[model samples]
Target chain A: MIWQLDIMFLVLVVISAIASVNVKDLLSSAILLGAYSFLMCLLWIEMGAVDVAFTEAAVGAGISTAFFIGFIFQTTRRTKD
Target chain B: MKERYPDVTIETVCRLLIPPIQLFGLYVIAHGHYSPGGGFQGGCILGASFIMMFIAYDIGEVKRRMREKLNTILCATGVLIYAGIGILCLVLGANYLDYGILHQILPAYPAKARALGTFGIEIGVGITVMSVMISIFLNIGTAGEHEGEPE
Candidate 1:
């Protein structure tokens, strides 16, 4: 595994994690979290855990993102705090 | 959400995309024993395809295709298949889920029987995961009042 790519994904993951929490719009937060999941998947692949990466891509990035969007539609899109 | 004007582009794109997504999901499940994917991941892919359909169309559309009762029944059936296989292995004079013993009934070698048994359980897991994902989305999206169209 290239250390550069690993570092890149690691930085991106941290940035997305913080951004998602700090975002005022819940929808944007959800999207950012999906991005975080994708980056984590990349890290997993780089570490040779291909099966975990596959699951992260499918459930973490794909299904959970859709679930979050669906949930956002049923509630307020903006955060109270 | 109120019914909005249907976007032809979105509908067309989703219709084209869903089939391939589902096919890939099945491929993942089928090749899971030798590959990086398995039942949970593949089933999530399959469920995500339907969720995409729900997004492009309406809840009524998905409901028409997969009724709540049918979905729930499918969820149970998957678990039943999983348990039945395990119990069958036990009744075959082996420990629970000991698939090597399956060779006695099937016309295959012990090792082949184990692979076949694992494949069967993967299928069961895939089925259960898919239905549960759909059920969760339906309940969350509609707030559990899925008897009729959202108003």
Candidate 2:
């Protein structure tokens, strides 16, 4: 595993995590969370955990994103806080 | 959902994309023993294809194709298959889920029987995961009331 790619993904993961939590628009937050999942999937692949990476990409990035979007359609887009 | 705004481009793209996506999912499930992918990942891919259909088309369209009763039955069937395999192993004079014992009935070597048994469980898991995912998405999309009204 290249240390540089690992570091890059690590940084991006942190940024996306924080951004997803802090974003006011729930839809954008959901999308950001999906991005976070994908980055984590990348990290898993780099670490040689191919199975986990596959799972993360499928369930974390794909299904959960769709679930969040479906939920958002039923709720308010903007946060109260 | 009641009011339809049909987009030809989206419909065309999804129709073209879904078949290949499903085929890949099946491939993942079938090759899972030797590959990085397995039942859960493959099933999620399959479910995602349906979710894409839901987005591009209408919920009614999806529901019509896969009725709620059929979905529930499929969900149960997968679990039954999984349990049945385990119990079969037990009845074959081995511990639960002991695949090596399957050779007595399968006419294969012990090691090959183990692989076959694992493959069977994976199929069961893939089926369960796919149905559950679709069920969750449908419930969420419809807010727990998926019947009576088209909305």
Candidate 3:
């Protein structure tokens, strides 16, 4: 069961990353990055690095995503690439 | 006052939804040790909660909710609290973060002393993380708005 969860989490991370890169809208891409961080946090929990996981969840999901959105606001949301 | 942006369904949903989630994030920080989380995790969660608010609501609304001064205070306080623990340990004649000495001073069990110490530092981390997040969000959202204008 644990292994299954791990695999699923990994797949989710990959999907989120791919979506983040492929998404045309910067805001949506930022959201995907946040999702990626959240999944990574779960993966850390499964790996038993609770402390690292906690930090990741907070900084990665919270700070980074917020920063990304803020960046989006100061500029245009649509990206050419 | 001027309207900076248009009202939308998504922003409306965010206005209704985000405050409660932020409260939960605080709970996560407070109860981190006992659960599967700690200060940094909870702090980030708290930060994210506000960030969500910033994103969903317009910048003006976010600014109204989070003032620049308070964010500065939060950042400094977190560091002070973290340093306070190390100072306490040093005052007790041990290296930084040497909780055993704290245990010697307190009448309670040594494990309890260590736990308490950890909690203190964790609180510091949480505060730092949350404030830094807010600051970052504000900076990013507001960047280049008045870049070359005289302050």
Candidate 4:
């Protein structure tokens, strides 16, 4: 059962990471990146490293995503592709 | 503050959600010892609460509510607290974080002293993480790009 959850979360992570890179709208991509980080946090929990999971959730999901969104606010929200 | 956007329902919902989210973040921080969550996770959640406000309201309101100078101070102070604890241990002629000395000073359970010491450092890390996260957001969100968009 735990392995199933891991697999499911892994799938979501892959999807979010790919979408974060591929999405045209900058805000959406940033949101997706946050999603990816959230999933990675869950993965860390599953791996039994609460400290690492906490750090990842804090830095990756909270800080990095906000930074990306701030870039969008200061610049264009659209992409060439 | 700028005019609240003409979405009464959204505003109402956000007003209700903010308190609960913030409270949950606090709970996560406090109950970190016997649980999977900790200062960093709780701090991230706390930062998210502000970010949500920023998105729901506006940047100007966020700036007013959480001034940049205060956040900078919090970030720096958090690190100082952590480093101070480590240095205190060093001064006491032990390793970087010999919590036993702390126990000796506190005049209580030694193991509890260790736990409390760790908790203090974790709190410091949390504060730094929270403020740094907000700083990164403010910096990135407000930066001006070069005038080279593909027009």
Candidate 5:
């Protein structure tokens, strides 16, 4: 059961990781990055690294998303690549 | 076109939301030893509260509550508290970062004293992390241009 859950989240992380990089809209990519962090935090929690998971949740998912949105505000939302 | 500021509903909701988030951050810091939270986690929550304010209203709104100078001082003060505790242990003729020596003054068992020492350093780390997160986000959000004179 635990291994399956791990595999599921692993797949999701990979999907979001690719999405964040390939998405044409910078804003969408930023949101995807946040999603990626959230999934990573979940994986950490499942592995019993509660403290590290907590830090990842707050810093990666929360602050980083805010930072990315703020950057988007300063620049264009759409990207050429 | 996007509006310059959040709607009234968002403004009211954020105002209501920030306090609870901040309170939870404090709880996380206070319970770090017993729970999954610690300095860095709690600090990030506190920083997110300020960031929420910035997102809802503007940079001016956050600055109105937390002044830049005060923020800078807090960043330094956290580091001072951490180092000061370590130095105090040294002054008492123990190794650095040794919490056991704190029992000499705190009137607690060596084990409890270490726990208290951990709490102190966690608070210091929490403060430093909180201020740094806020500072970095503010600087980046404004592109090195922030309102309000140094005060």
Candidate 6:
């Protein structure tokens, strides 16, 4: 239970985190950030932190994504970095 | 320009799903003692339902259901409920948040009173969390353009 799916989600977390920072589009970056949160939540669940996992899924995946998109509407989507 | 879909599919689906999601959120908050969920999780889910409403339709639709005034009151009320419980316990000759003193008023054992107290605080947490999330989303969504201007 500890090590079974940990490695997979760990890799995913790293990938998504990096991708979120590297992406040029702010919207895409925001979505990637959400994906990172989701993968981290999965890892938390894998480790039996179900409460934390639920929080991450709700706040990270649900609310933050909406905030990001809403911010995008208010601001610009293009990113120089 | 905001994108608007002509079809009613999203609207129909969201209408059907919103009630169930809210019910489940309440259940999570109430059933936290017996299950893995608690106040925070349930509040977030409840907040998400409103957000889902926003995504499915327009902001006006959600505003009609949950007004800005009610939202503001909820944020303050939730925290008040939490602190009020602590104060009540203090007045009851116990330390802050000590629910054992609640047994005097309730007809249950100390342990049961404590459990009931815990549940009360969880409800407070749920209300505050749900309102805060919604408030943050609304503020950031409008970028303060809607602030100080009650409509």
Number of the top candidate by lDDT?
A: 2
lDDT of candidate 3 over B29-97, digit per residue (tens): 778778877777777777777777766665555556766677789899999999988999999899998
Candidate 2 lDDT tens digits, B15-128? 999999999999999999999998888989999999999999988888877787888999999899899999999999999999999999998999999999999999999999
In model 1, what is the error at residue B61, expressed in angstroms? Answer: 1.4
Model 2 DockQ vs. reference: 0.91
The CAPRI quality class of candidate 3 comes to: medium
Report the lDDT of model 4 for residue B131: 88
Q: What is each model's TM-score for chain A?
A: 0.92, 0.93, 0.91, 0.89, 0.91, 0.89
Is model 5 an incorrect, acceptable, medium or high docking prediction?
high
- Which tens-of-lDDT digit does each residue in B45-133 have in candidate 1? 99998899888998888888888788999999989989999999999999999999999999999999999999999999999999999
DockQ metric, candidate 5: 0.84
Per-residue lDDT tens digits for candidate 4, residues A1-81, read 399988999999999999889998878989999999999999999978878888788779876787676666666436567
Q: What TM-score does chain B alone reach in each candidate, compared with the true chain B?
A: 0.95, 0.94, 0.81, 0.86, 0.94, 0.92
Please list the residue runs of candidate 5 whose C-alpha ends up more than 4 Å from where it truly belongs after superposition: A77-81, B1-3
Tens-digit lDDT track of model 6 for A1-81: 867588889988999999999998888999999999999889988999898888898888888888888888887645567
**Over 4 Å off, model 6:** A77-81, B1-6, B147-151
lDDT tens per residue, model 2, A41-60 = 99999999999999999999
Pick by DockQ: 1 or 6, better one = 1
lDDT of 5 by residue, A1-81 (tens): 399999999999999999999998888999999999999999998888989999999999999999988888888646679
Kept native contacts, fraction for each prediction: 0.97, 0.90, 0.93, 0.79, 0.90, 0.83
In angstroms, what RMSD does candidate 1 have relative to the true structure?
2.2
Better of 3 and 6 by DockQ: 6
| TM-score ranking, best first | 2, 1, 5, 6, 4, 3
Docking category of candidate 4: medium
**Model 1 chain B worst lDDT window (10 residues):** B142-151
The pairs that clash in candidate 6 are none
Pick the winner on DockQ between candidates 3 and 4: 3
lDDT of each: 0.92, 0.93, 0.79, 0.78, 0.91, 0.87
Model 3 chain B weakest lDDT span, ten residues long: B142-151
- Which residue runs does candidate 1 get wrong by more than 4 Å? A77-81, B148-151
